[model samples]
Target chain A: MPIIINLDQVLADRNMKSKELAEIVGITEANLSILKSGKAKAVRFSTLEAICEALDCQPGDILAFSSPNPSQGGESN
Target chain B: MNLNTFFKRLIDLAFYLMVPIVVFFPGTILYVLMFPEQTIINVNIPYVENGFSGKALLFSMGFFALFLLFFAGLYQMRKFAGLLLKNKLFSQEVVKRTHKTGTFFTACALGSLIFIGINSLFSYEGKISVTFGSSNFNLLLFLLIVGVLFLLLSDAFKKALAIKEENDLTV
Candidate 1:
């Protein structure tokens, strides 16, 4: 859950609808919705590639990682 | 017929056969109770002179309760098989039915052990005897092993369902 999907932001920047992106990427609207909602357990490399190609953006533009407990820092015992 | 079709037909046959057997069990018990002399079930407990004695009735009732539990487990198994036939193999309903089936079987097994212990107290008259040669003992032992195996199978099915759900969510 620490990893976030910024698909909406990327889509907004590209000025394309989710339906249009899904059509180009060859995936169902429900699957696209799952990816956008951050409910997806994983993203296949082929899907990521397809999305990137459809949106004309890098993978980094769609995916972001935010620390869940930033106050605890990265140290582990 | 193909394997899937054959299995489906087999399950359907088993389900239908079990329905009548389950329905007949209570009727059989009632008949045995009403006319003890004409009883088809010969429950021979040592030292109990009459077949319809209080101790014998107690044993029979306890056994009937356990048999009901076993039948309930079988019903759950029928539901599980129905789901499998429909290809809803990894659904929550399948897991729930399997777990319920396992619980019923395990409860029946434990109940049988307790029933045996109580029966032994009356039959042996406070004397502790270990007899492994009895058909009843072997049947109870088999039920216990089968119940444990079903419980293990349920756990495995639960894990498999989790994996399947995770796979489904992966996009």
Candidate 2:
């Protein structure tokens, strides 16, 4: 849940539409929508590479990890 | 007829045949309980006098569980064949049906075990002199193994279903 996809922001920065990005990346618009909505369980390396190439953005720009419980830190030592 | 239609027809025939057996079992049980002297299905089961004893109750429970196992197993097979007919493989329905079938088989195995224990009790009481046979023991073992196999299959199907869902969700 901490891993968030900022696909909408990346698309906005690139001034690109989701459908156009999907066409360039060789994925369906529905799948692109799933990615945009952050409902995807995993993103394949090939798919990430394709999306990066299409949108001219790094993977870091699209994916960000923010701790849901920042104070807890999730570390058990 | 083509192979697809042939298999479909075969499953349909099996399902139809099983329906009457499923229907007849409980009906026959009820009839035999009501009129023990009457001949049904060319066999007359003597009525157990003095109401239902613990042994009778357990035996009936075991019989009911086995009937349920047969009904549920056949129903799942029918559903699976229907899914094949519809070309659907990765669905929750398939997973659920498999799990239910496994559970039913497991219950039937346990039920048969109860029957063995009660049979021993009845033999000790001298109400019936029938000894438990090797064939019955083998059948029990077969039921247990089959039950465990189906349970393992259900678990595998569940894992496959999860993978399919994750793959479908991956963008």
Candidate 3:
């Protein structure tokens, strides 16, 4: 829960639709939606590489980690 | 030669066996009920001297209900075996069938105990007391234990299926 996917922001910044990215990354739209919704348990390195290559973004630009608990003194949202 | 393959084949055998068992047992019951005198089912149990009285009919009907419940349990077992053979281990259907099997066995256990208790009460000529350590009592206890075990297994299957679904949907 601490890790958040920034795929939507990256997709928007690149002016690339999720469907187009999914096609280029060789993954289904449903899986892309899961990533976009931040519901994925763990992304494979190959998938991460494909997404980064498709959007011309770094892994850091696609994923961010913040503490989920308020007491941890990090933003959850 | 492979163990997993052998296990799967065994499950397949079990699945097929269940079909005949469910069919034959119920068919046999119907045949016996239709020709009670012709069948050996009532040979062990004593018949009323006045012939099949109201109480005898009630007893027969009760036994029929119990037999149906037993067959229903086997039916659920058949479904579970079919699913297992197909490798649909973590599906909702498997969980539901497992739960149904457990419930059916539990019902059979309770129904048998109640039937025995009522039979003993009616057959007794004098003051009533609960019988202990009888064969029927032991069978009831065994069924109760097995039924509870299956219920626990069903709960475990439910939890495992939920986790599997979550993992599958996680992408």
On DockQ, the leading prediction is 2
Error of 1 at B119 (Å): 3.0
lDDT by residue (tens digit), candidate 1, B98-163: 888889988998888888777676567666656666677778778878878878888888899999
Relative to the unseen true structure, what is the C-alpha lDDT of residue A13 in candidate 2, on a scale of 0 to 100?
Answer: 90
C-alpha lDDT score of every prediction, in listed order: 0.80, 0.74, 0.77
Q: In model 2, which regions exceed 4 Å deviation?
A: A72-77, B1-15, B25-65, B124-134
Sorted by DockQ, highest first, which candidate order results?
Answer: 2, 1, 3
How displaced is residue A15 in candidate 3, in Å?
6.1
Most accurate candidate by lDDT: 1
lDDT per residue for candidate 1 within A21-48, as digits (tens), equals 9999999999999999999999999999
Q: Name the better of 2 and 3 by DockQ.
A: 2
The candidates' DockQ values read 0.75, 0.78, 0.40
Model 1: per-residue Cα lDDT at residue A37: 94
Interface RMSD of each: 0.5, 0.6, 2.0
Task: Chain A only: give the TM-score of model 3.
Answer: 0.89
| Candidate 3 local lDDT, residue B153 | 86
Task: Itemize residue pairs with steric clashes in candidate 1.
Answer: none
